[model samples]
Target: MDRIRPWLILVGVFLLQFFLSELLAIRYYRPDFVVIFILYFGLFFGSYYGVIAGFIIGIFIDMTPLASYFGLSPMTYSITGYLAGHLQDKYIRWSPFAFHAAWLCIISFHFLVFTYVRYQLLFEVDIVQYLLRWFLTMTYTLIFLLILQFFFPIKRIQGA
Candidate 1:
């Protein structure tokens, strides 16, 4: 049951995101709910689980024809998951500020790598517009992440 929950959430988010987008008439910015799940699982389960989740989810997204490049998402998301899982390490574990900082960096890195690699083979890259898009998308995603936490609080056992 514990093992299945996160994967179920990932699938739910993937399906929910489509309906939510069309229903909400969302435009301009979109949050990556998949990434949020990856982050959460990574943080909770540590690096091994994180890498596996990221790769599996990323591969699923690519198969949906969502990827601009065939393997970019798997590569990037796997890295993001690995980093997020690093938060579990005692030596550099979560302080409120450090957690947020790491979150920001991972998301930003995802967007940057995803965008750049995809667009590099296309037209000239517009740095300003790219940065603006990155900022907005990252901000919107974080907001969704906050809401997600309210509904799905991390389960903590007492006196482990």
Candidate 2:
């Protein structure tokens, strides 16, 4: 069951994201629940698993009929996972501010690339609109992350 647990979580999140994401959408802004799961796995399990999970989950998402770009999701999610995974054990050595900043930057980069690539090809979007969409999506996702932190903060265990 231990081996299966992570995959189960992946499937659950994928299903939830697929079926329920539309309901969560407010115009172009919607929380990326899949990225949250990838972040969790990467942060806890390290880069090897993180990148793998990201790639697999991303491919699943891309395979869906709703996906626009073929390789965008996998590329972005894999990069974010690898970055998050590298910071896993190092969080303990850093100051609180620095740690938070690292994650904030990672999340910002993820949303920035995601939103930009998505809009750039579909339409010739203005800079203002691109920035707004990026900001709104990142903000919405961060709100969910904040709520998650209350219940289960992302911190390293003492002697795992």
Residues 39-153 of candidate 1: C-alpha lDDT, one tens digit per residue: 7778778888989888987887787744557888788889888987876543234465666666678878887777667656332557777677667777788788778768864
Per-residue lDDT of model 2, residues 1-160, tens digit only: 9998998999999998899888989997888998888888888888889899989999999999768799999999999899989888776688878877988898999988888788994336477877888899999999998898887688642122
Q: Please give the RMSD of candidate 2 to the true structure.
A: 1.9
* Pairs that clash in candidate 2: none
Show how many residue pairs clash in every candidate, following the order shown.
0, 0
Q: What TM-score does prediction 2 earn? A: 0.93
Question: Lowest-scoring 10 consecutive residues by lDDT in candidate 1?
Answer: 151-160
RMSD of each: 3.3, 1.9
lDDT of 2 at 81: 91
Name the lDDT value of residue 62 in candidate 2. Answer: 97
Error of 1 at 84 (Å): 0.5
Q: Roughly what TM-score does model 1 have, to 2 decimal places? A: 0.80
